[model samples]
Target: MGSTEEERPEGLLGWCLVANVARETLHGDSGLDLQHGTKHFSADALLWIPPIPWDPGHWRWPAVGRHRGNSRRYINMVVRAEDLENFRVKGVYSEALVRSLNGHRHDPAAPRTLQNPWSREQAQSWADRWNQPREPVRIDGRSHPLLSVPNPPPAELRVNGETLHLAHYGTRGAHYSRNPPPTEQP
Candidate 1:
């Protein structure tokens, strides 16, 4: 049996909400199992959780959260290497801003932040709301869900004879030379 590119199961790419304290302790399996595993879904376009450190000025940086005391932070579930192929450039989100969300009590009806070992509902809501196109918001002065479903950053890799170059989002890049090191003249 064989499968075509389109036929292959669209790789699952989504985030799971985990507690800040348990951020480093939790594994993909445990993260997936949170919220009764209801938030888990077949992600088609993008998988990275935003507020990446590459841009500290962005709102999501440091992880956004509702205002409340003794509140536990939320960290996105880590995506596995095998799943990298599913992402644009194997784009992996940062775990830096562990507790980086705007802790504002703007709306009294807004959902409250959860503490360590978050409850199933907290996990579910976070996962469900992530990158929801319908829910409009601005980040880094840009409208989010950027059309309801954010598209993966554009990535390209090319080789020119003796050099290899790879770039993504024009924000970062990598280059390498194929030539061997010069020999020492003794």
Candidate 2:
């Protein structure tokens, strides 16, 4: 950000966690390490709080995933060491696991998955672009009311248990079509 100012934020720090969780990257026990619920890990001196993706109005599981009308529910969250919460167990946590996810703070829109690996960099930029106090994303022109939920990146990242599986991913022209065979992520 110091040198690349105009195209990005004024003080953009490139070292940010990227907050990435693509199914391909989270495959195996790796996904298990990054469970759906919030976690209090140290990405360095900065505390990391990976909040579970959820809803505000009815306090239900918010939809998430790549394709249209499809959604994946997360099950964990993390907070900074100084954050006001603690992990009491280690299993499939229920709704009660997250008492104050600030549901009053999340109105997430399942943004479309980034269509390219280069866009992975674009999606990473949102770490700084959307981190500030702002409104959540909008789908079909409607925004979630909470306005604090960190919307999913404009890319689909699926994780089975603790593993990221590239079931089938690629670009448009050469993508895996339902008719024949499933391909791979590029």
- Give me the candidate number with maximum lDDT: 1
Across 88-146, the per-residue lDDT of candidate 2 in tens digits comes to 11211223212222234432341221111122244345445544433223322333333
Model 2: which ten-residue window has the lowest total lDDT? 169-178
Query: How well is each residue in 1-186 modelled by candidate 1, as lDDT tens digits?
Result: 555544433431223343221112112542343221112222231333332324434222232322223124443333332222211212113232222321232233533321222333554565455423222222223333322212332122232332322222211112222333356999
* lDDT assessment of candidate 2: 0.27
Off by over 4 Å in 2: 1-45, 49-124, 135-186
Worst 10 residues of 1 by lDDT: 83-92
Candidate 2, number of clashes: 28
